[model samples]
Target: MFKTRIILTAVILLALVGVLLANMVQRMAHLHQSDAEYLRLFKEVVAITKQSYVEQVDDKKLMTGAINGMLAALDPHSSYMPATSYDEMKVHMAGAFGGLGIQLGTKDGNLMVEAPIEDTPAFRAGILAGDHIWSIDGKPTKGVPINDCVSRMRGTPGTSVTLGILREGSKEPLSFKLVRAIIKTKSVKAKLLEPGYAYLGISEFQERTGEDFERALKTLAADNGGPLKGLVLDLRYNPGGLLDQAIRVTNSFVGEGLNDGLIVSTKGRSAGSEREMTANIGDKQPHYPIVVLINGASASASEIVAGALQDHKRAVIMGTQSFGKGSVQSVITLRNGDGLKLTTARYYTPSGRSIQAKGITPDITVEFAKKPAQPEKKKMPEIREQDLDGHMQQVGAPKDAPAASEPSAAPMDPKEQELLGKDNQLARALDLLKGVNLLKAGLK
Candidate 1:
């Protein structure tokens, strides 16, 4: 009888605690009319699923799916990262990661490639800018989350991943079976295009990009035998990376005198979100004519660099409009090692121009096009006796004219093939730089 009384007392206490939790949930739900209705609906669905579902589903999986759905509805950039996904993100931010090396985003409910990192599997596979990813490994990508696509594409190095791509001009989707590899990005690449003209390609801005860019400039100067007369800063296919690196890149061009001038600014709801970034006075690059190359693939930090340099009159912008991704994502880690990449702020150019949907417009627009192969010249109608004006007796059977010699095609180095690859954009940038230099000399 005593044992039975003890069990009854424990049951009574448990019933009281359950009653208290139910009251708290009711009060929270009543905070707003819509909240109350939604909470009711949420409970109904969960109760129904638990009682009548085909198979038993774990509560944790159900809660995780709910959270993912909620965040997905917010924006394309905001999402909940599972523990594994969060770990991969940490690796990416650390500047080295394994994957196909293509930066992609969701566009029109489909996956689209923003840009492919240089020297990576994607780049080596001839994946050009503006290619739409229709599917991955035979799975359709329509309405798929960007994070899901990223997670699926990235895996162990040397593993094969097939992508169904719909190129801009192609009539049908093309399939590419690519082997993923560890992508080690060389953020800054520089070489002299000519005696005094330099070409610098910034693939992406990272923690080390600022210093790497400085080193590249010095190397270019040494190659040119002096300070570079002009530079073609190629941010064409660069998908922006770090915020600090963007400011540093802009500073490299703008130099020391106006270190206090605004480079870029951020505004958010939080107290500390509003801030202006500026350049620092250190190892400033020489004042030289700069032509910045951009394209639809350039975005975020890349836009910051372009906008800052343009506003300061430091570089002449060229190429098509950028991929307008002006928002900033702050990664917040949760207690369970998961993370939330939330869009906490929007980026503005130095002139207060919002870069959200309206990307940086180039001062000069240069559309990319492949140069058509030259057609072979037809041999002039053989000089016939009837057509000859003054028909003189042919001294002897004219020896067959030697077959026209064709120009020998030489193999181009990777750098040359990249910069001048059938596109007129880079060529135009170089011409603009030369024009600037000529005008400066004329003024002198």
Candidate 2:
């Protein structure tokens, strides 16, 4: 009873002191004043925390935690990022990063895969973006904060880490032992798939993505050595990065592939002068046909290309609904080595489709899975003010309106619906390409 009373007294004293200190801080901020009492209270708390706490705590961590808490109250996307997190953010915005080559984020404070980079260990290990990381080496992660869990997940090269994952439709949590390797994210992949289709996989719209794609195309052209068949641009699971890179990709399809097409043009100041860049400068429009593959994971920059192609009648877009992220975020480094990613603009397609919440509807629609039903929630694109400078305004969709809030005519047609489903969409695209090819060969 005596001990309990003592503890209660201490708590009461602490609360009183905290209230007093808080009032002082507020008054000081308002009056632009300082006092010895404020300093004394702050120092006293620091000393008490260091000397009397039950467990050791980092001062820097405590300060940062306070900052993060303050920022989090403002919005979900706005928060304090430490130096390490800031660096990773830079790498991601730049469209590449070195690590295990997996994209990860927090869901309910537990680490989950956003997606694994193609051919990386996480991909090889079959770690999917939506898989929940339940534990690290059998250590329970429930209720664990994401940052601490990530630290345990990442380690030196050649080191093995065990992950306990819970995938959708799994009977029980599965365990996988994976070795961490140095991952330099490669944004573009190209290959010859069928006789008439050259397949390309693009992970994101990173800074170097366009250059990487051109090189991939060169290799494809050199290998074919004959008349071009059709080009398949696979932009599944691509969270957009750079705006210019997206434009460059669209330009590649418009001018030099196989037929004549329109190049995307922007009109805003600082968005700058319009130039018609071609595949070969004067090759007219591409002579061959094109098919674009997109999915719910495809976002921002990817949508720009897809929307532009569809608007210009340059390529038949295929796959599921894309991520509706039409907004652009420009990362500005702060004085503390952290980054501030702020929304910039809203982008529009040549036909003026707002890719915000309403992603670009493919000319053809195909679900990712063979038989997809409604209720499987796919990621919606993040459209910002940064995404809409050049593209045409929606038929009636407002240029400055928030995503999906603008008025629309009756929903788009059936042909567009087919162009946006998953597998069926790709097959229909092949049919379109073959027709283009036959026409080019005078075989139509």
Candidate 3:
């Protein structure tokens, strides 16, 4: 009887395994069929375009346009890059490139100057934030795609590009001639706010950003005669860069004492794309009060650092809301030296909050008090992720919720000797840091 029972159980287990294998095979076959159908449809479309188009379209151009359209339909960050553009991107990551030194974007079908890097051609030429690019050279830029505008601006060093800009109070478009050069920016700048208080400004993250930040902090400590009582990290107008540099910067502040503490996590379709970056105990700065300054231009890697510090309760975030750009784009190089900048993942803060369309709100809101003589009726507002042409919506985000908005920064006074002296936001951040230090001393 025992031997008969064992034979029946074995038969049952084998039958169950066979059923599971059959289902797996069926699923794989269905996926293969779907892929084949998609390819057939795509080929049909290409064939029709090749035969019916008015001009003799080159096969290479058709393929490139199709790839670009596919990625553009996915999200704004996803893009197809040619060989030259891919080379330029590599130069940008290495922290040097020849161009106007300005970040570009599109707003309501018009080219907009997102922010001008300090001490660059655009900045020196007096290209203010929120300026509408009316024309590039003599051609109207009314509906030009952003990538095309970028290509027009970048050229060999010592070449010049002309821009027709429309400012807020200008009665007509103004033209400025800018000469391009290899712009090499120092990512980190530091100074002593006062004895025991330091001010550090990160213009952008680059290859050596982490190393530069550590060296800046050490120099500030030596200048202050001891460890810092408080520090203000300024990320205003900082367009973000490499993800590894963002991680390195965050690790400097919050990772040392906290073991396996979450900094950020990414979710994507592939198992390999999902990742969680954590901080480990290592060489960390002292437990001093930190205040992070952000504005509408802070984005990408900048948002990562700010979100992580805010989530970990390691710093007080102050200023206007940041530029919402929480998607991660991975540059995948093709066999022909071209590349595809594809949006592979969405980043989440340590507290599991996705700041894709909704940026980091300041813990304390501080606005600079400056009124323009004539504010443009249709002012270019802060460009967030939602403003992009095909930005990805956050996963599980509310469909009916309105797009997030950022407080517009007061127009800067160009003639002012020291803008920081009149910056209300910076003043408030400094005061907060000072108050925290005072509280700690009193408690002791």
Candidate 4:
């Protein structure tokens, strides 16, 4: 009886294995058939274009354009970079490039200026964020690829390029003739606001931004004569840079307790693209109040840092909503020194919030505006009883001794006043930090 039972079980197992093998073979055949059909279609189209196009097209150019079209169909951030463009990108990541110092993006098929790097030609030429690039050096840019636009704008140092811009409030397109220079960006700028308060502006993340951020923090402390009480991290107009640098910057303020020190995580179809980056155990800032200032131009790594800190309750986010750019692109260097930047994943904050099309909203919504002008001191009418005609006099009290004049406030520092006058968002962040510090000390 036992031998008969074993024989039945073996026969059942063999039948199950046969069914699985048959399904695998059928799926493989289907995939092969589909792939061949697509390849044939692509070849036919290429041949037709080469033979009957309006103009003679180079084989390399045709292939490059095809690759670009494929990537563009996927997303805006993904693109194929030829060897020259790839080399330029490497230089750009290293924090120096010869261009107009303006970051570009696309919106509804129109080329738009993302942000002008601080102190660059584009910035100095009054290029504002959200301005549409109508033409580049007399050539229409409506349908040009972003990489081609960038290449056209960049040239040897001291060269000039004219951009026709369409600003929101302007009736006609404005022209800006800017002389390009080698743009060497200083990523971090720090200054002490008061004895215990500091301001750190990260223009953009770069190769050494993390290390530079740490050094700036130390410098702030030294300038303040002790540990900082509060900080205003200004990330306005900061189009983001390297991913690892963003993580490193976040690690400076966050310690290893909340959410298991999870700063950010990425989710993708492939296992290799999915990842979680956590804060390492190291020297971190004390439990000081922080207010991170972001604007509509803050994107990518900027969103990453803001999201992480906001999730951990480590800082108060201020300013307008951030420029939502949560997708991660992995740049793969191809043979022949060309490259491909492909969108691999979408990153999430510690709280599992995705910042893709939706941006990081600030805890405090402060719009950008100039500091209001101080009202003129109106002269009093002097309409007291003493000044009234036929009014009763103070018989005993000696003519109500003129009210002692209040001491005038000490003059504000010229630089501080200038800064507050220009940046109302930063001014608001400073006020909030000050209020928080006062509350912590039980004085408010």
Candidate 5:
């Protein structure tokens, strides 16, 4: 009986202290003062109110609200995550967890798929990466948190879920029925392109991106079983995930020694004091010419790889401009399982080129303009950033940029995106790799 009474007393005391401390902190923002005895009385009243309040109140929720409100008052990006949210975040960073295998994000109140993982139910059912998600089953996912929506999409394998998909130019959303499955996303995919050339595609940079990429390269080399000719690294729709992965990708082509430096840096807190990540050249070194393909949708970690290769002149970059997401984000976890993913630093290439707003420019720019297609008479939705290019949020670039300036960016009157869509850049990159192979062979 005494132990139970002691436990109850401790909880009550903690509640009183929390209430008192919160009130005290509020006064710091303004001008209020209090002393001991009356302060104790105020805390006592607070405890009584909390214990006997007519309506139930979640103390934990109230505490979280206070913390979030405090941080949000400072800046737009600064926010808090709760415990439930923290676990969901693990899936994003690690890139494996229960999911529908479709990468969904919002750009203007519309839920859109950045891309779909290969071989997942979503991908198998003919769901394209750029397909927009209108609803889960029949309920609208609009205004829902991305994490919460993702959680709703995930369940045990073999569980079926209905999705309403909206693609560009479709007036009505399409119905897609998918069974939840364990999607083992392969960060790297490689195959021999012709006899001497190899083609590699990185879907997303993860902890194992380098390992997977290296494994693919080795596989290609074994299949060739001869002096390699060239290589093509394809980072088309990869949104990018980790920094270490980017470094490894760059190192693969740069080779050991000869300081064909493949990194970019920026002005730091001190002169020449910027964080420098040098290329760790590969032993195999590709043993031939190299090419890298990047589109306007490649971003962050992807940009890092492309930028490094371009800087070192290790690979010829052939494609349109890249997605200018040069800022580096850091996820800071809280006491509660939630975390704050904030842009901690702005990244630059080893050549000191800042990718912020201005993405990596290709060495040989291959502009992809839309081609004419079958005329559709449907009235299209108002053109927006998302409509122009999926995952290519080229904000902070040169201002006064005209809408539909790049023909490949959108499907306008008299033209469709066959001129711009579906590994168009990758195909061109493969052609570049083949050319390199032919040139090397000619030299021999």
Candidate 6:
């Protein structure tokens, strides 16, 4: 009876295996058939274009265009970079390059300025974020690929490039002639706001950004004479760079106990593309109130840092909504020195939030506003007691007794005043941090 039962189970298992094999074979056949059909169509189109084109096209150019078109169809971030463009990209990632330091992106088929790196030509030229790039050097940039536009803008350090920009509220397109320079970006800048309050600005994430950030934090603490009481992490106009650097920056503030130190995760169709990056065992900041500032220009890695901190409840995000760019790109270098920047996966925050098209909403929504210039003080009519018609001296008071002077508050640092004056969002962040510190003290 036992042998009979075992035989029946073996027969059932064999039958299931046979059915699974058949399905696998059938799917493979279908996949091959579809691939073959599309390949044949592509070849036919290429042959026809080569034979009946207005101008004689090089074979290499035709192939390159085809590759670019395929990648462009997939997404904006994915692109095929030729050898020269690939080289330029590598240099840019190395934290220095010769160009007008404006990060570019596409919005609704229009070329848009993502952000201008601080102190660069583009930033000094007043090239604001969200400005539509209408033309480059007087040539229309309507359908130009981003790589091509970048090439046109980049040249010798001393050379000039003119960009025609269409601003949101402006009636006419504005022209900006800027001289390109060797843009060596210092990723992090730190300052002590007050006795324990601090401000740290991350302009862009680069290869050394993590190290720079750590150094900046230490500098801030030293300048403040101790650990920070509160921090305003300014990520405004910071077009994100290296992914690992972003994770490292986020890891600095997050402790091992929070979400198992998971900073971010990625999901893709392929098993190899999916990944989870967690913070290392140590390297956490002191528990303090933090306010992270982001604007429309903060994207990719910036969004990652913001999302991670937000999910952990480690920082209060304050500003306008972020520039939603959560795609993870993998750069594959070809043998011929060319490269392919492919969007392999979409990253998620620790809380399982995919901020792809939907950005990280700030806990406190603050719009960008410039502090209005102080109006020139008018000369007040001096009506002193001695100048008044019914002025009378006290019986025992000295004639020249100095008026009782009120205690004056400490004067603000000129640099801090200038920075806060121009940035309303930053000012609000400082206020919030101060309030948080006060509230914590009160509760204790």
Clashing residue pair totals per candidate (backbone < 3 A): 0, 48, 0, 0, 11, 0
The residue-by-residue lDDT of candidate 2 on 1-444, one tens digit each, is 999999999999999999999999998886654667666776787788878989998999877776676555533344566678887666565753334666778787777889887887889978887998888888988888776676676667788888899999999989989888766667888766554356677887777888888788778877767545777788878877777788777777555433444433333334533333223344332356677888777877888787777766666777777767655455678898876664444555655555666676666666655564766677666443235333323322623111100000124346534543545655555566666655555642
Which regions of candidate 1 deviate over 4 angstroms? 1-37, 97-183, 258-260, 371-421
Mind giving the per-residue lDDT tens digits that candidate 4 earns over 263-315? 99898888787799999987788778888998888888998998888888888
Q: Please give the distance, in angstroms, between residue 178's alpha carbon in candidate 5 and its true position after superposition.
A: 11
lDDT of each: 0.78, 0.66, 0.81, 0.82, 0.68, 0.81
TM value for model 6: 0.69
RMSD per model, one decimal: 21.8, 17.1, 7.8, 17.2, 15.0, 17.6
The digit string of per-residue lDDT tens for model 1 on 176-213 reads 89998987757888887766777889988877788888
For all predicted structures, in order, the TM-scores are 0.65, 0.56, 0.71, 0.70, 0.59, 0.69
lDDT of 5 by residue, 1-444 (tens): 999999999999999999999988887644533455556776686677679989887877656676677566643335677667667656655756655688777889878898887778888888886787879979998888887788889988888999998888778879988989886667787766566666788988876788888777778878878655667778877888888878877776664775665464433343444466776554746446666777778887888888776666666777777877776656787565578765455677656666666677777777654444877466544322133222223333232111000001111222222322444665576556656555555676
List model 3 lDDT by residue over 1-444, tens digit each. 999999999999999999999999999999999999999999998899889999898999999988988888888888999998898778767877788888788789888988998889999999988899988888888877787887788788899999999899999889999999888757899987666777899989888888899899999999878888888899988889898888888998787545547888899887788899987677788878788899889998998998888877788788888888889989999999999898889888877878887788877767655556687466567787778887877663411111110011123334321645667777676667767666666676
**Most accurate candidate by TM-score:** 3
Cα lDDT of model 1 overall? 0.78
Pairs of residues clashing in candidate 6: none
* CA deviation > 4 Å runs, candidate 6: 1-27, 96-184, 256-259, 371-411
Q: How does model 3 fare in lDDT?
A: 0.81
Task: Indicate whether candidate 3 or candidate 5 has the larger TM-score.
Answer: 3
lDDT at position 224, candidate 4: 72
